[model samples]
Target: MQETRDAFVFRGGAMAAKPEIGSHDIEIRDCDVKYYTKRGFRFRDGCYDIQVINCTADAGGKEWYVEAFPMSFNVIGGAKGTNVYDHDITFIDCIASNNWHINGDSYWNGDGFCAEGTAYNLTYIRCESYGNTDGGWDDKSANPLLIGCIAKDNKKNYRFWSGAPGALLWNCVSAEPNKRGGNSDYVGLWTKGKIRIHNSSFVDSSKPLALNDWRVTPEQIANMNISVNNSLIELPEGKELPAPNYTVSNTVIRPLNETGLSANGVGYKKDMREAQILLTEVRPHQPRIEKEGRLLETKPLNVFSEKNPSGWYLSDWNNAKMKIAKGKGINDSNALEVSTNGSKGGGATYRTKRDSATIKFANFQKSDWALKMSIRTGSTNLSGLELRALTMAEAPKTKEVPLPGTLNGSITGWQEISIPLAKLKASASEANFANFAGFYIRANGSMAGPLYIDNVRLEPMN
Candidate 1:
């Protein structure tokens, strides 16, 4: 549990190698080191469980060359071609800047950090790397995870060629806005092993590619259940391409240049030349949660099951009055009562006068969750569905969040809607209860129009 600080300011190429440091849990915190004549911080033979937090290292070099020995040096080093392994190490909130090298050179002087031989379980969280000549992160080991990290204006943001497993890039952003001197081969992220990229963005780079050829064969594509959702991939003009080996959903992919599609006897403009259209679809296989006993059920909600009548439900009222009509379905016969007013329009408007049928739950817990429901226009009079959570003995109060406004489409089909639980809690701050109660859905002022709802479920995250 001991903390140490070693802010050594080494002269360029003038520092000598230190003796081996024994294995210990070390925390290198808030240190500013620069201009190392050699490697900045060498992990000695037995150094393990090292955590570097909020540190900054500026490798002062314009171009990396072995001959430029006095001015160019790597930031960290372990003996090359050795069997030494660095494991359980994390670098959080750090910066590695101004490390550059000549184009097309394979030297090690300009890399932010180089991990050789069996390095495992290493992570870089919320770190920044800029102006690095060679690459932002070069890992030749296994089990490296980069989360919420940024590497901008670098020759290569990531270059990993070693045989490693669990090499992942999650919520990372790689951008290269400058396109000069270098060949503009600004690959935002490049990996050569098993990699999983989720919820990440790549913008304005020469080539943003993911290389999975190391482990994946052409035959495996037929037997995999894969899905890609909620990702944004943008490229410089003329570089728009389809995502590899997955169906794209709720994603925005736009290339900078004009291109065309030549498939399925249909052709369309690419990139900026084509109009940007919004298309939304829902896959039924994704799980939804429900309340079970005294806890939120960890299983997906069965919207299609007859026992789980908690499926998406909707109704509509005519005019400005709140009332229940013959078209509305009621789950609890006695709880729901509606009334209508003949306001302004010839069509009668209805509103909910009491609680509707309750979707029973076992218990409630304070956790992050999600609820998704689909709403479709049944009769078209600009209707909406309202959801509320209430205690067993009291009148149910409205849980109003910034749900999507009146959807516009034909009154013939369903539209899928996903609402995050955080957003719902924030908007309905006054009505949310601590105990696991129940939830209900009611329509706004009843119009003559019909409102169809389906696919309602809750999702709880650990």
Candidate 2:
């Protein structure tokens, strides 16, 4: 980095953005930063839209592996009136390993990945941390979300907070004993906000949670909405804690889509867990996409939880044969099927739950997403198939934008499709997209026979 920067230093030093002074798009992928003196890749001084993917910061001799400073700090002039902070920063499929200073002027802040005072709009997906003095991810910032991320053998697996009052952690894994393999010696995850955690796995890390959980008194509970749904945990014997009210349901001591979780200290490698139970999935072992691809905002659209959400009704095959059958899905046991003869084409209607149990998608109308699905179609030639998300029954989202995208009916067996969310149409307000109706599957305007579906999800693209 030093040699490269020196060879290419412009008028403004090696520093890329003054943040408060401007904004820039910085993308670094599949690179390594090791044995740096000050900080391996430092970002400071204002609002920046930086994306670092499939990167690693290891053996940094100083402060942090990867660091970012919001636009407000101790400078000559200062950033008092400047309201701009580090905004739209994302790290995908990255790792920070052994990034702690043994002895130095700034040994006090030797964290794997940290933001000193306050930062915002930060997202960490499919990242890893190991053997840091402070913690894996010490997010002193606001509105930081961690998805499909993992931490092990660190003093603290995660330390996160937000300016607002919520933490969205989905499908993550943690095994912590402070990198020293001792009990009650470290925290799995420390937080200061409401939490919506689902399909995650927490292992034997001294103190599993440092937040207000089932062990705390009523007064000790943080004044926040806590929802821990469909997860797994394994504590030291005799340390079984009470289940929090927010737990939709959970289990213990089961391999919940996790591996390489032994007591032996190890660095966070690429992901091998192959499952898409959450909105955005970050895995170490992937061949389809590169380590660093799109830094866009990804969210999982459909979350068919443990029990199916109420209010959804099935259509009895107009031109296609559709029925709610059992035991045929990609991951789950249940599935929806459409089967028939190829002469006359017809399809089924799949809509969102309109009843009290309707599950709504967050940030739907706000950002763009990629519609994804897994389907096994039988040998049939369906003329037309459409995937739609909207409220209006007769019209699409808007004329300029169509509600659905035409599907290639000639294909067979299991396959996946992703469509741009921006192309979706709506007749009403996009805000609180949850307010709109659900996603619909209309197929077989002309086709031969069977269509099987499962694991339908939505991911944020930006």
Per-prediction RMSD in angstroms? 27.1, 23.3
Q: What is the lDDT of residue 447 in candidate 2?
A: 53
Global lDDT of each candidate: 0.47, 0.51
Q: Residue 36: error of model 1 in Å?
A: 2.6
Worst 10 residues of 1 by lDDT: 274-283
Clashes of 1: 30
Q: What value of lDDT does candidate 1 attain over all alpha carbons?
A: 0.47
Candidate 1 residue-wise lDDT at 315: 39
At residue 81, what lDDT does model 2 achieve? 22
Question: What is the C-alpha lDDT profile of model 1 across 191-244, one tens digit per residue?
Answer: 554455545666666576545444667764333322324545666666544445
- The lDDT of model 2 is 0.51
Candidate No. with top lDDT: 2
lDDT of 1 at 158: 72
